[model samples]
Target: MATTNQNGGNRRPRGGRIRAGSSRRAQSEQTELHLLRTATWLFSERGFHGTGIRDIADAAGVAVSAMYYYASSKDELLEAVMRRTLDVLVSSGEETLRDVADPAERLAAVIASHVAFHARNPRAAKVADHEFHALTGQVRQDILQQRDAYETVWSSILSAGVHDGTFKDRGTVARLALLQMTTGVAHWYRPHGELKIPQLCERFAEMGLALMGASREGRALEACDVNLPDTQLLLRRAELTIEPREKPTGL
Candidate 1:
């Protein structure tokens, strides 16, 4: 059901006890993630235009008024879903800030982290990138900002690698194309249905690296065409290559 834009994750509290310093605002965000995940499933199944506030409230097991407290309209709920999706991708970046000193390894972590996160939460992933145009006003701008920020993560990583000798990309086109190829992973990933996240991530990372740095092993990965159980990745890449990038129907 995920188109190409939305991304996602479900946040569950840990150990039956809130963290020692978890603040009230943090708890509120957790509640919103719960509501957003529920709405994502409903929206993906019913389509955003087909869903209603009462439907989301019922699906989330919350009062309609409670849903209204966080999102006044369906558009606002859509924005919430986008923010939640971006939050996951950004969170994965934060994990490597200090631990990953090498640019190549850091970028590898970024790709692996992204593919893994999207594979874990397909509905939210789809809603964030695919269903976000259904927003209005400042909310739409805010979602765009989050999305641009996510892209910047890729842009910055490539730029950094280019500065050093660890990686190489000819231009922004090549850089973006490589990143989009990885993003395409989410559009077709299925854990139980076919390939595992690690397999997809590792394989795609190899291709991205090979395209950029021409890593010897990566080149082999690119040439290795063992058929996967599901032809999702090949099919997705083929569709993306042919499909024109359409302008969004902005709300």
Candidate 2:
């Protein structure tokens, strides 16, 4: 038999124990997600060193004790957030390029996926970009490891394109140039602005192919046509917003 709570929830008992661990796990996961969201906002606005554990706890509406239960310290929390951000980018890139056989198409897919991720996760992307100096020792190395792995995807694509005679700039400079250009979308993209997420991905994919010296004839660079997720939808999922900035006083 199962016990019913006041909220109409059922509690089952097995082996002299209640199935309360599932509920506890769900609560813990929710708390951790809130903490990550709060930290991403603070780090993007005030920087990693400027944000304190209490600030994150208060923003997430959790007690300081509860915050500590999830993240032992501010540095640990920062690393966790950054590590997760890079992990997401790496995983997304790999998944996006998995079925892309053509070298030019693979490069285009990488660019499109990168742009979408940044536009969706602006706060997390900004924190990852600006807070590298704040991490120390092993934490910095761990985050960079994930970053390098993600970069390798693009590097391999570029190398393959060059080998196939479809790309010309087969050097580190071209890779950094394309990456810097696409990653900058996080700083200026707006969900409800002039261009929607799909248009942005298309334009960015074209620009990336052009930067790589690939021919822009016809549909050769239309890599984002393979079902990339919308940036606005992803932003909504992460609960991050982008508002217009006010003009400076006496500008």
Candidate 3:
């Protein structure tokens, strides 16, 4: 039997379960997102060893059993968070460099993207940056591989700059320093703080060029005109929301 809904449209019979699949999927996604956000906050605040599955469930307003349905264990949840962060970082890096052919410009764009992502999603960045030690076995190896892939993006840019004489051959040291410097933004950047995202991106991009010894005046000028992507929008589209939490005290 069908019944008239508020819109004066016939509703399917209750036994039919017409909308059940899509409705359940949407609810599942929401629940999973909630769990991820909660776990990211807790892991960032308390460290992996300090946080437990029950803690994540309680904070997320879900039962432990329900949380288990999304992630079988805390390790799995941590892996998911880390993987999501890396996925965004890698994809954004690739997207930023797609049309950028000049080495100096590529390097600047990469730096800007890194800074923007870290500043926008600090907690998730912190977890991805600092919590790898807690993961063990296959998951740990997988995350490390992703980290290496991201590093390769930077390395290739640096290598190109060195090859083209646009940048000094500072080798791996420069690469590591640049990564550390840009990624460190996640530690201290605040949305309402004095430095805005665009400014930070420009300043950091300039600093990166300087660090690379890119002294070609015209090239440096052009390279600073990097187009930083909307990291917040990207994360939101990826279903990764940044939940508000207390300011981090220290590393």
Candidate 4:
């Protein structure tokens, strides 16, 4: 009961109905994405407590009643944003580490990726870092588990480097310190400033290596290729846009 359409695809009975269904699904997806992007920006600018469901719906240009179709509550939206940020971080970190053999090189690559991500998507990074305690119950636990998984990646790399005599055995202390140092980049990095992402990556990688006591062997890390996704492309993929805000005075 199917016939070939112009594109050689099978056309079934009630094809108009099928097309309409598909269109509605696509529109629904677009609306949810718009809500998520708007929520991410709002939550980043105003703390989660300060941003309400109505705020997100209004900013997304959706009726307040329609938001419940996508998310049960504002907490659900925050959880979605947090999960999305972690998913990107974990997947990107894993991809970056693939085929990178040397311990120092691995550490450098991670530092590069971390610094680049924070610098490029500062708003999302800020939300991920600052809004942890805002989530409650199982949602908070789930986010914590995800966060630990990402931290384990760094800890494993540091452990390997230390075992191989490339880095100091500072253990958990080193891992926490390195993450704090790199994540802080999201707070002050300016796109129009003198430091390009690549240079910033290199600088951060060098600092990370030094922090791990690999300074003597870190010369090679400085030259390691720091490949990362383009910032604009990443923002586009996430359906998010970040407008420039007034720069804070002083360092």
Candidate 5:
């Protein structure tokens, strides 16, 4: 006998896709996300090897084989999380590169975008930065490539600024360090707490510029420094809005 639903029609079992877009992938995606979240908690609480697939399946209320349906292994799940993460970061920075041509402006936008994302999703940030090493073979290489591409974008801008005399930085080392510094925001950012995003961004921007040897002026004169022309030492940032992040396409 066919199993009938409340409407008296025979109902398909779980994971069924049918006409009228009735079985949306959205549910599947949500289930996958749920599984990821549960696994993340487990992995964080217990080491990845310490946590078993059965544990994740039990926590997610899915069968062990069902877990394999979405994620081949815990490592694969981590890669998915990391890939989405890097994609967002790289894409956001790319968008930040579009409008503003100044290296200083580009740098600020990158920092701001990075800070916002990490502050907003610290868990994802933590996992991406730390747990990524847990993946091996090709998955590790893929994550590394994405990360390297992201660094290259920032490096290019910083190098351009140095060449044009807009920014005075040591080299890729310091520039990369500056980029990594923003991740600290992930360690202690609380959304509904004391500081808001805009305020934090401003403070971070000032700190980063200051580190590059830029000084803050008094209230009246200070406003002008934000627009200072590109010299061997200064950058005007008041008008420093970046263009949207875009990817390169074929000619």
Candidate 6:
């Protein structure tokens, strides 16, 4: 015998609620974001091997079953977090620097955007910087593609600068050094610290330009006409919402 509705029609158990339209998509995105936030904190704190699906679900205030709605497994959840960071970095970089032809200005914009992103999304940045070895096989490859996309923007900028005689051709060494310096900002920068995002970006932009030999043209920092998108505006443009938290609070 099957359960019957008030009208006397038999009703079958539904596996999941079917949500339609923009409201449904918005809700799904929200849930996925919540999961990413919870997982980022855990993965950063406990290391990937120490964190599990139950840990993520518990921290997120959702049941383990609900997690399956967003991701098939914890690995997938981690990958989503990684992808979100890369998406913001790559999309924001390309969008902001796309129209600029001068390599010095383009590189300044890249540094400003990169630093601001790391400052705004330190936890996610830290996780992406530190958690690569934990990801396996195809997942790692896919994430690296996103990573490469972002890196390629910098590479192109550097190569163009060299070709146009605006920067020194120290080869890949200079590029790697610049990236490492800018990306490492996430490790120690704090929202309450003396330098805010904009100022921090400016400082790093100056440093990056100097590293690339732009100082010779007296275009090290303020002289360079870098029209970087405002950090908050850039985040909105990228559709990335990163809620700032205290250092010890699990993301």
Which candidate's TM-score is highest? 3
**lDDT, candidate 1, at 33:** 57
**Candidate 4 per-residue C-alpha lDDT over 1-251 given as tens digits, one digit per residue, 9 for 90 to 100:** 13356798965332011122464877866666667767777888898999998888877778888877667678877777787777777777777788887788888878877887788778878989999989999778888998998999999999988888888888789999999999999899998998987778778887887787773444433434434334344333333232223221110
Q: Compose the digit string of candidate 3's lDDT tens values, residues 99-203.
A: 888888888878878888888788989999999999898778878998998899899999988897888899799989999999999899987999988778778
Q: Lowest summed lDDT over 10 consecutive residues: which window, candidate 5?
A: 242-251
Q: In terms of lDDT, which candidate is stronger, 1 or 6?
A: 6
Winner of 1 and 2 under TM-score? 2
Which of candidates 1 and 4 is the stronger one according to lDDT?
A: 4
Q: Please identify model 4 stretches exceeding 4 Å from their true place.
A: 1-21, 215-251
Tell how far residue 87 is off in model 1, in angstroms. Answer: 1.3
In model 4, what lDDT does residue 227 have? 45
What TM-score would every model get versus the actual structure?
0.66, 0.78, 0.82, 0.79, 0.73, 0.80
The pairs that clash in candidate 6 are none
Q: Report, for every candidate in turn, its global Cα lDDT versus the true structure.
A: 0.59, 0.70, 0.75, 0.73, 0.61, 0.73
| TM-score of model 6 vs. true structure | 0.80
Ranking by TM-score: 3, 6, 4, 2, 5, 1
Q: Give the distance in Å from residue 137's predicted Cα in candidate 3 to where it truly belongs.
A: 1.3
lDDT of 6 by residue, 1-251 (tens): 02346788844222112122475777776676667777888887888889998988887778888777666677776676676667677777777777788888888888877887777777888888899888898768878777887788789999998898888788898889989998998889987899888788778887887787764355544434555557676555445553325332332
Report the C-alpha lDDT of model 2 over 60-112, residue by residue, as the tens digit. Answer: 77889866666667876677667777767776777777767887777767777
lDDT, candidate 6, at 201: 79
Best by lDDT: 3
Q: After aligning candidate 6 to the native by TM-score, how far in Å is the CA of 184 from where it should be?
A: 1.0
Q: What does the lDDT read for residue 228 in candidate 3?
A: 48
Relative to the unseen true structure, what is the C-alpha lDDT of residue 157 in candidate 2, on a scale of 0 to 100?
85
lDDT score of model 4? 0.73
* Decoy 4 TM-score against native: 0.79
